[model samples]
Target: MKHLKIIALLLRNSLMSHLEYRFSFIMWSITSILWIMLTLISIEFIFGHVNSIAGWTKNQMLLIATVFGIFSSIMWMFFLPSAINITKLVRKGTLDFYLLKPIGNRFLLSTNQFSLDNFPRACILVLIMFGLIDSMGLKISFLSWIQFILFLLIGLGIFYNIFFTAAVTSIWFIDIFNLEDLYANILNVGRLPTHIFEGFTKLSFMFILPVMFVATFPAQILLGTADITMAITGLVILIQDLRGKSMNFLGFSH
Candidate 1:
């Protein structure tokens, strides 16, 4: 409960800070919507020439894209700022202040910064998802909805663990400031159907980088073609990775 209160306070402060610059926030929200539209337009253009890409229908592709947009918006809202700030903190030699705090450094660092600007984008993506489902005539069961939400949550955790792991490496490589941009580029690939990849590339994305977890699996759940074994395997791998990284962070702080 104490930690929950701290998180609430952090969110309030962050929201207030963003609200202070209302014009900037509004502009950011507009830009986010434009970006999402541009992505959808590109997909539409591609489907104009091909009936289906990798056996994924136009609506299916749109669903995956929408899911990716939501995941991206959430990451930008809650994690991206902190991931970038961690690098700055490391470079400035001020990370120890967070380490000395009563709260866990990992929790503190992850929640210290938030971007409320992406909230509108997340909402828009969700609406778009519903529209896609309706147009596709998908009859998603209640169990499928539960599974979709669960996979999304798991995907968010896995993404944070992977990105946080990369960000914390700034402790050793302070000059690698472009890691966030690189990570963003990699994640953009999740907007496409994972079926487009073959053999080694598919395996690499699934297990090595696990970008598929970011959207593909959750989208699959909605499509009624989810691979439970694959999702479970990815979740297990994420748990192991998070556990190992948590130990590493603790060791570094001490």
Candidate 2:
């Protein structure tokens, strides 16, 4: 409960800060919607020439894109802003501010710069998802719905582990060269069906990049095609990172 209250306070303060700059918030909404549309267009154009890629029809592809959008907004809302910018703090030696705080540094670093704009962006994605579901006539069961949400959270955890690792690496490297680009490339793979890759490519993504579990595996769970191995792997990856990093899941150790 104490942690929850702290997170809530952080969110409230960040929202207040965002409210002070309404223009940035408005511009972000526009760009976010446009980005989603562009993603749809690119997927549709590819489908126009081929019936399906890796057995995913146009509707399935759209669903994947929607999941990707929601996940992107979630990162933007919290992780993206903080994780990407930590390099700046590392370089400037200002991380002591967070370290000196009474609370956990990991929580402070990750949630310190919450962007409220993505809240509405996530809502817009939900509306789009419902419209897509209605058009496709997908008969998702109550249990599948629950699994979808469960796996989504699981996927988010795995994603944070990978992304948090990247931020930690920045502290050591000091020249984190194209950190955002690295994450974006990995995130892009999740929007596509995992089966689309073969041999080395597939192994690299499934294990090394790990975005396959982050986005594709959860969508597969909802589609009734995901395997249990990937589920276990995701859990193990999260636990392994927590143990290896700092014996604490937050990455920074003092």
Candidate 3:
């Protein structure tokens, strides 16, 4: 209950801060929507020439793209602004202020900068994915819906793990400006089907990059063709990262 109140307070303050600059918010919204359109165009460009890159139809790949957009938007909307920026704050000593507060540092840092403005992209992507799923006439069941919800949660966990790992990496390399870009590029690869890759490429993405689990695996599960091994590997990575002995997971511990 106390934690809930703190979250509510954080959200209220964040919303207040966002509304302080209405024009900037509007411009951001415009650019965000345009970027989504561009993303869809890029997907179309790839599918336009190739009859089928990896046996996935245009709609199937679009579905993956839509899910990726939603995942990306969620990162922007919450994870990046609030938690991922903590590294900069730490380097600047701004985090000292957070440390002095009463709330748990992790919770406060995680929720401090929730951007209501950036949520529209996620909303749009979800709607687009739903529309594509319906148009494709894929038969979905209650069990599949449950699995999809689970996959979404796990995808968010994967996002959280990646972003947190990047931020935590700042404990060692504080001036890495392209940290988010690294994550973005990895996730962008997931916009296409995993099967598009041949031999070693498939193995590399499924394990090293793990982007396939974030978008492709979830879409596959929904489409009734998920690779159980990939899904398990992603989940295991997430769990290990969360409970690992790494400095990031251990919170700057020695």
Candidate 4:
């Protein structure tokens, strides 16, 4: 309860700070809306000719885009900045500030800061996604909804572990900016459907890097293309990865 209140207070303060800079906030919101619109337009253009791209209709692709945007927004607003900076903090020995805190270290690291500026973009993406789905009269079953949520949770879990593992390694490297971008590129590969790729490329994305979790699996659920077994496998893998020890093999283990 106390922690929830603290989080609520932090969120409130952050939102208030944004409102204090009303014009900047509004401008940022408008820019994000325009960007999402342009992206949706591009997807439409690609699927305009073919009835389906790799068995996914335009609406199915839009769902994937929405899931991508939502997850990506969450990462952008919270995880990326903090994870990237943790490398510098570790190098400088300033991580002691976080370690000294009387709370869970990983949770502290995860939610120490929240960015109000990114919420507008996430909200817009969700609105667009839901609006499109609803317009199509796509009957989303309870089971499918559950699978979508489950895959989304697992996807984020995988994403966090991968990033955490990378950032922990950067404690020794010191120059991690480029490495972070490479990780982003891996996630970007899944911004579209895995069906579009063939043979080795599909296999690599699906298993080797597991970037397919970022959008592909959840998109399948939303499009009624996912089976129960696949969703269960994803959730199981995510849980196992979460429980496994994070090894900083590249960097000196701290």
Highest TM-score against the true fold, candidate: 1
Q: Each model's C-alpha lDDT?
A: 0.86, 0.77, 0.75, 0.75
Off by over 4 Å in 3: 245-254
Model 2, range 91-115, lDDT digits (tens) per residue? 9999888788987777778777777
| Per-residue alpha-carbon lDDT of candidate 4 for residues 109-185, written as tens digits (9 for 90 to 100) | 65566677888999988898789789878889998888787777777777777787777666667774676686678
Could you tell me which residue pairs clash in candidate 2?
Answer: none
lDDT by residue for model 3 (1-254), tens: 99888778877887788789988888988888999899789878987788666788788888888887787777777777765577778788787787678766666667777777877777888889889989999888999888877877777766676676667667668776766677677667877777878888987777666667668887987789887776886678667755543334646422
The 10 consecutive residues of candidate 4 with the worst lDDT sum are: 245-254
RMSD of 2: 2.4
TM-score of each: 0.95, 0.89, 0.88, 0.85
Residue 76, model 3: lDDT of 71
Q: Which model, 2 or 4, shows the larger TM-score?
A: 2
Instruction: State in Å the error of residue 212, model 3.
Output: 1.4
Q: Which stretches of candidate 2 lie over 4 Å from their true place?
A: 246-254
Off by over 4 Å in 1: 246-254
